[model samples]
Target: MSLKVVVVSWGQLTNVVREVQSQLSGEAQIELVEGLFDQQTTLEMARQIEASGQVDVFVSGGGNARMLRHNLQTPVVAVTVSGYDMLKTILQSRTGDETVYFVHFSEIIHELNDLKEVLPFPVNQVALKTPAEGEAFFNELSRQEQPVVIVGASLAWDLARRHGLKAVYVYTPKAVLEALERAVELARVRRQEMEKTQRVQAILDFACDGIIACDQQGIITAFNPAAEMITGISSQGATGRPVGEVVPSLKLEAVISSDRGLFNQLERIKDKEVMVNKVPVIVRGEPRGAVATLHDIVTIQKAEHQIRLKARREGLEAKTTFAEIVGESQIIQQTIAQARQYARSEATILIMGETGTGKELFAQAIHNASQRQGQPFVAINCAAVPENLLESELFGYEEGAFTGARKSGKLGLFELAHGGTMFLDEIGDISQAIQIKLLRFLQQKEIMRVGGQYTIPVDVRVIAATNRDLLAAVREGTFRADLYYRLNVLPLHLPPLRERKEDIPVLLRDMLFKANRALARYAPVIAREILLHLPAYSWPGNVRELQNIAERIMALALTANLSEHQVQELIGMVLQQGAYEETVKIKAGDLSLRAGERKDDLKKEIGNLEKEVILEALRQTRGNKTRAAALLGVSRSTLWRKLREDIS
Candidate 1:
């Protein structure tokens, strides 16, 4: 028993359908089904055909198959007049360069439009409202020296030829017939390709491991669903963003340069040790990209150990210390100094800055500089963990505390940070309940785990950082006032890059040097003009923005020397093109007062101001020109010459 294929009539290609069926008669069983030109009748025919469950493949011309495909489970094959068919038909009907007209049905206008795009000669297409109208239009077009192309089926072709105008019949040519056969073959191949792609995507999506792919340039091309689940970043958010910007652990350039695949069971990122496997994807004997898969090794190990303990129990390894901190800004240095002083005395330190400004660096610096350097430095991002999971994460949980809870127990962040520092990032984002728990911990130096009765005493120093204004939050009743005062004991605000313009040159040089070593490229020279522009522009993303720009500059500078002017030009283009969300706009006057206007106008204004100042100074000095010159911070001879010139 063979699969039954159905062929439906459409347009004027009913004969063509029968011809194809005859050709395939011995190869397969094909059932020919005919329907009216009307859409509803065609759709009803498809529904009846589908109900029979006898059709295995649906074939028709123009929209017949398209309409049937929507209502039927069978494969659809649509045949239409090819471009070559329309072109050849028009050229053959023309005598010399004399104008020839072709008439087409209104339904096939789109095919005619496509023909116009690919055709060499200028062709005019007129749709037939009625056979008479089409004949009249064809006669009018026949008067021109050029040819008009009409695209339709056999019946329409005969109607135009009857009008005594040169008429060409449009249908699929031999080449097009072969092309359709190839297309069907290609569709089978494409289906296989789609299946393979979907399988790979599903494996990447559902796997517990995080997967990330980067191009040869080290820019992230793909981040899988599991990657998003682990990293708390969505594929939509991570795509096109640099790997360094997203994961901060990928070390994209190093991975690219090594060429050799890396498989390490103890790689650390975001404070979790994980097994990482990096493989280079090579095409045509050249490296194209790299794929990395990572899973939390410690969590996996602990889970494995738990399973074994039931047969055996297991183990761990962690701070805010200055030695652990990394930054070289004067603002950071001053912040560290203040944090150190407060750290030894048990004063709550409030480290304030924009997100990613290294508030945790300051917290660590304070912890390291203090007497509690030997203790654990537990850091938590208040905004990262969900509210439901936040309490368990902060305070720990007893066995069987909730569904899917570990059989044994979990140590809260406070317990883990006992005898050291707890750096809370985005502290202002914490809810009132968490704030209450935090305040109690600060007041009593004790924490009660979820579903646990006894309070565990812990000696931990709290250092909190927030991009938000805690004072404002407090006034708005969103944040507790008591917690604000407690945390605000030693306030240190890290100024944004724009404010500390003096630090940019030093920062840029240092960043470039570090990047050079990491990226294995020569550090480009920093132009003074670029430095000047850095200060004028406001850095909404602050130090992080500067870091990213530096990386971008390094990447762009690989093939060319990046001058200060080039840097400014790039910044201007990005601003003009709306690449940067917030940018400072400098007018022509701001660039230079003489810019975009006549120099004479500026000189006149300068001259008037200069004369007024000189006269006033001379009058005040009682015409003792030497005194006026001293007051004006100029030489006595210069003032005398100016006075003489004015008098003359």
Candidate 2:
């Protein structure tokens, strides 16, 4: 990266430049050319050197330097004629009694005016403002009767020598060396500036965002390629034009005037919805200009959607559908049909059922059967994850949000589930603070990350499931009523296994078949005796409990056939002896026992205990329902609700 200096000179000055070049040890590379002022050949030669992109500055004298400066962008240093050069030239060119004529270009050298006091003889000074003027002076010199010694710049001296008159060149070797040094320094500076400009241009060309810059005068200084595409205007056409005239929607003038940045501004620009961000550029406490970055809103959304869907992000999947539910009973079919109808809707769904009742299974089924099947399906169990971690998992967290947070931050399940469904299992287990946030999401369809300063909108259908009665939790001030109502927009209740006994046999077969395929073994079929006795079984865990029994039996597949007692043992383990509970029914406010007379009708027995407790509470509180409810650790409304149910 040596600095290049081009010197256009001839005759004496050319010899001086060669002397300077030979003596120099600096980084500058001097190229000497034989040329004169206002010559087209010399101008073309300089332009070709510049076009090579290797030249930094041009060095010449008088009109030649001015010509290059006017025609080119590279800095041109005009070799200056000092008073010492002029005095030396005059003293050498004249004898003690001869008249001396000195020609200076642009202006008379005022420093030489004081030289008259030091010199023995008076010197006549002539100023030539232009090359034409210098040519006229030389023409007039040719007609003079007396032969006067002429001393002037390179152009003037060349002309004097051409007319066959004695002439002295005014430039010394020191003057040429000084000009070369100045050109080298200036070239270094100009090269640095050019490098900076080139880097900026590279960024403008490669950035994905549309970038436009305006000067303090509201004149567009830069319009990058992306901006050209966005605005349908060329950079060449936009630069130097008033920004308002080029793209008034930019409001660049307003941004500059305000001296404050406006971000995320959604506006219609060039017949397209664009997200614009404008920031005022300030340099040394002064407004230099304003820069704006534009993004097509539709383009941004499409890219995000494509990334969410095509990425098939981790922990986002639903493999179950209605056909996979493995149920044929009327109640189960009706529930599936209703869920199928609900799946077609965009409203929030609240699936209510006990634990081990396939709440999340139904959620996945609904998601698969819905229009958003191909999209993400995110499911999170509210009770399984800790409250703090659940908050971060559900809504995400920013980088450095807390100690040990990931530096890159996190994307929440809500964001991952964008354009799909988010199933919040065990929704009732979420804290009240989370309920507030969930309520906002169900109402506004937006979520704020754990450590985020902004809210991001998510287009996701919500389906919340819970084994706990959310309304009861709401009355107990545990679950938020607003959120409960939001999720209950499309409620789907799953019946327990005891209520849907007809599906037990069907479920048992499906579960065993699945277990067989999974373990690569033969599946054992439960005896008809066990299934017929299943009518007497009170399966608290619904079809999920039936699945447990099937898997247990499949593990004993090599046992040919299980005895009634062995089958009962496995069933007892699955239900924790729930299958042995005697059948009981309420008849006209009377407790009726069908299978046992041991007075173990659990519901009626609990009713009798509850009646005795209520009588005791009434006796202690003088029949004040509020006081009695408070003593029983229940709300007055709950006590009244129980009383109303008893009356009905």
- True-vs-predicted CA distance for residue 360, candidate 1, Å: 0.9
CA shift of 62, model 2, Å: 1.9
lDDT of each: 0.66, 0.77
Clashing pairs in 2: none
Off by over 4 Å in 2: 88-95, 104-120, 127-149, 155-167, 303-648
Best model number under lDDT: 2
At residue 415, candidate 1 shows an lDDT of 74
Question: How far off is residue 229 in model 1, in Å?
Answer: 46
Rate residue 10 of model 1 by lDDT.
48
Q: For candidate 1, lDDT tens digit of each residue in 279-393?
A: 8877787888788887877667777755743331122113435654334567656766666677677778888876546677677767777777766778877776778999999
Q: Could you say which candidate leads in TM-score?
A: 2
